[model samples]
Target: MDQDRGYNNYYSSRNSRQYEESSNWRRGNVNWDSQWPTDRYSNSDYYGYTRSDTPFNNYNQSSARYEEDYSRNSYELDPRTMEFDRLVELLHPKFMSEYLNKILTFLKSNNTEICFPHIAPYKEAFLVRIASDHKNLECPAFDETCQNISRSIRDFLYKNSKLFVWSHSYESGKITKNTADTASSPNVILKSSSSDAIDKDSKHKQSRLKKKQIELVSTDFKIQAMKTILDFIKDDSRSLLQYPDLSEVQANFLYTLLSCYDKPEDGAEKSLLLTPLVEALKIYSLKYQFRINKDTNDEDCRFITLEKTLKGKSSENNFNDSLKSPSPSIMDYQDLDDWNTDVENSDATDHRSDGVPDFGGKLNKNQRKLRYLFDQVTTDFKMTVLQKSLDYIEDNSRSSVQFLNLTIHESRFLKCLNSFPLSKKSYFLIEKQCVPLIMKLRRVLEP
Candidate 1:
C-alpha cells in the first residue's frame, strides 16, 4: 500500500514538473514544441485517468483556441493600458446593484427547492439537508444557479470588495478590510490514507463535509454580515448613503461574501473573495476608515469607507431618505436591529474557518491542480464546470456497480480541465465559490 502511494506521488511530481517546465514555453520565451503527453496512463497515476481515455470530442475546441490566442497574442490586446474599469465597463453600477437587490429579494422570498433533473443518491441527502438549512438561496453545487443571483453577488462583489481600502486601491487589489486576517490557505482535506481500522473515526468526520459546497456560504453568515454593515451605517456611514452608486442591500451582499473566504486551498478561496470585494467597493466608491478617536477597545473599523466624489456628484441627497435600511422584513425578521441583536449573540464571521466548515481537510496533488484550474477560470466558467462534475457524480453514485472507474465522458471532462489554459492573477477576487462538488469528486476518485 505504501509503495503504491509513493509511486503515485512520484509520478505526480514528474508530471507537475513537466507542466511547470512547459510554463516557460507558454510564456513564449523559448521556441518549444508543446509536448503534450500522448500516453494514456502516464499522467493518470494520481488523477486516475490518462489522455487517451478522455477524448477532446466533448470539450470546447473554440474556447481552447481563444484562450490559446488570448494567452499568446499580447500585441492584440489594446495597446493603451486598459484599466480594470475599462475591462469590465459593461457592468453598470445601477444595473448591478438593482439586479442584485431583486435577486436578494427572491432569495429571501424563496420558500421551496427547485427539483433537479438528476441527483446522486449519496448527494441527494446532503443537498436536501443543505437546502433545508439555507431557507432561500440556491445551491450552485447541485443545480446550475451560478449565473443567477448567486453568481452576480459572488462574481460582482468578489471583483469589487477590495476596492474598499485602496492599499494603496485595497493595496491595488491585494487585500480587504473585512477579510484582512483570513487564513492564507484552507484547512487540509482530511482523508483516510490506509484501509486500516483507525480509518473509521476519520471517515465519520469526513462524512460530515462529504457534500460541502464549493462556495461555503450559509444564510446565518450573510445575516451576520448584513448586521455588521448596518452597524457601520448606524454608527458612521459618513453620509456614504448619500452616494448614488452605493446601496444598502448591495453593501450587505458584498460584506457577506468577501468575508466568507477559506483556504485549506480550495475553490472560493480568499483571493476570489478579496478581488471582487475590492472591485465592487471601488465601483461604488466606498471603503472602511478607522475611527481614530476610538474607546481604545475597538480592534478595527468595519470595511465601510465611501468616496463622495467617485462619480464627482455633489448632490447632497437625503442619505436616510434614499434607500430603505436593508432589512429581512420580507421574510420573518422585523427589522435590521432585530437581526443585529441575534447576530451579536451568534458568530459574526459565520463562514470563517471556525464555522461549520466544508474544508480544513486534506488534498492530493491532482486535487490541488484541480482546485487551481477552478481558480484560473472565470467565476461563471468555474461554476458551470463544477455543476457539470456534480451532475456526473450524482448520476454515477446511483449506479450499484462493483467498481466505479472513470467513464469516457468523465475522462474527457477531466482532460479538458487538465488541458484547459491555465491563468493566474496576483491577488484575490470576490470568489471562486464551488469547491463542494470537486471535493466530492476527489472523495469518489480517491476512495
Candidate 2:
C-alpha cells in the first residue's frame, strides 16, 4: 500500500509541474485584451473563410495581431507625450513662480526698466521661462499653442540680442519755464478790419475768423509736444524695445499729435516727426540715392527757406554757387552698353581658394567699373544736384529777409547722412558740394 501511494504522489507532482509549464507558455504567446483563443484558429469560423488549409488565413491573423499590438503600445513612450507631461509639470503654480522669479531677477540685474508694452504679466513670465530654458527644454509637438509660445520666445530673445537703440533727443531734459515763455511768443497773427457801415457783415466775418483761429493751434504747442515724446524715450526707452519696427512708434507719436491739431500752420503742417523719420530711413536707402521731396506742395520744401535764412553769411556763397551752373541730368552718365558687350565676350574666369567657382567675381568687376563711372562724373553735375536741392528749398523770393531752410528747425540732416554707406568719392563729392550748405543751414538752425 505504501509503494502504491508513493507512485500516485510522484505522478500527481509530475502532472502539476507540466500544467505550470503549459500555462506559462500560453501566457507568453497570447494577448489578453480581446476575447481569448483568437477564434480557436479556425478558418471556417462565422467570421468565415472557405479555405480552411490556406496559409493566407494565418497571414491575415498575424497581421491583425501585429496591428493590435501596435495600437496597444504606440503612444506608451512617445516624445510628444513626454514633453506634454513635462510642460504640465513645469506649468504648475509653484514651478511657474520659480521661472517668474528668475525673470524678475534677470531684469533687475540688467537695469532693464520696462517690460514689453503689449504682453500681459503672465505671458511675459512664460516668454522669459522659454527664453531662459530654450536649449534645455522641449515643447510638445502636438500642442500648437505651446509651439507658438516657444517660437515667440526664440524670436524675442533673438531681437533682444541684436537690439538697436533709437537715440533719444531729450538732451536738454525738461523744457524750462523761461524757454517755454520764449517759445510761446506769437510769430504770426491774422487780423481783418471792416467798416462799421457794414456792421452785420463784419459781425458774421469776425465770427468766421474767430472759428478759423480756433482751428489753428500755435506752432509752439506742436514743438512742445515733440519735446514731450523725446522725454518719454529718454526716461523709459526699455518699454519701446519690444517693437520690431522702430519707425512705427515714431509715426504713431507724430500722427497722434497731428490728429489733435485741426489745421496746422503752413510750414509746420506735418508734425516734426516727418524729418527725423525720413532721416532714419535715409541710412538704409542711400545706395538708392534717397532724397526728400523739394516741391512747394511738399511741407519739407516750405521749411527750406527757413533753413537757408538761418545760413546767414553762407547764403551769399550759396547764391554764387547756384549762379555757377544749371542742374545735371541722367544723360551726364557714361553709356555702359560697351562695357556689357565686353563682359559678355570676355572668357576670363576666377576661382576661390577651395577650387569652387567664383560667380561673384564678374559682379565685383562690374561694380568696380560702375563706381569708376561715378567717380569720373563731372563736379558740375554734383554741384548741380546740390544746388537744385538747395534752391528747391525756396526760390530766394524774400531776398531782403533770409527765408528759413528746412534745416533751420533741425540740424540732424548731416548727422543722418553720416550714417549712410557713402563711397569715398561720393563722400568727397558731397562734402565739397553739399557739406558747406549743410553746415550753413545747421549753424543758422542752432537753438
C-alpha lDDT of all candidate models, in order: 0.32, 0.33
lDDT of 1 at 403: 14
Instruction: List where candidate 1 sits over 4 angstroms from the true fold.
Output: 1-218, 221-238, 241-308, 313-447
The ten-residue window of minimal lDDT in model 2 covers 174-183
lDDT of 2 by residue, 1-447 (tens): 232222222122434443322332324433433523445555543222234523344756644554554333323222223243443443444534444354334322433222333433233334433433455335453245444444554554446543311111111111111111111221111111222233355346544543344346455544554464344334422211111121322333333333323333222234354445333333323322211211122222221111111212333222211221222211122334445554455443332232222344343554443433333334454455445545644554422121133231121222222221222222322334455554543333233
After superposition on all CA atoms, what RMSD does each candidate show versus the true structure? 33.6, 26.6
Writing each residue's lDDT as its tens digit, candidate 1 over 7-100 gives 2221234355443333333444433133434443364532222454332442355335434644443322221222222322322345434434
TM-score of each: 0.14, 0.20
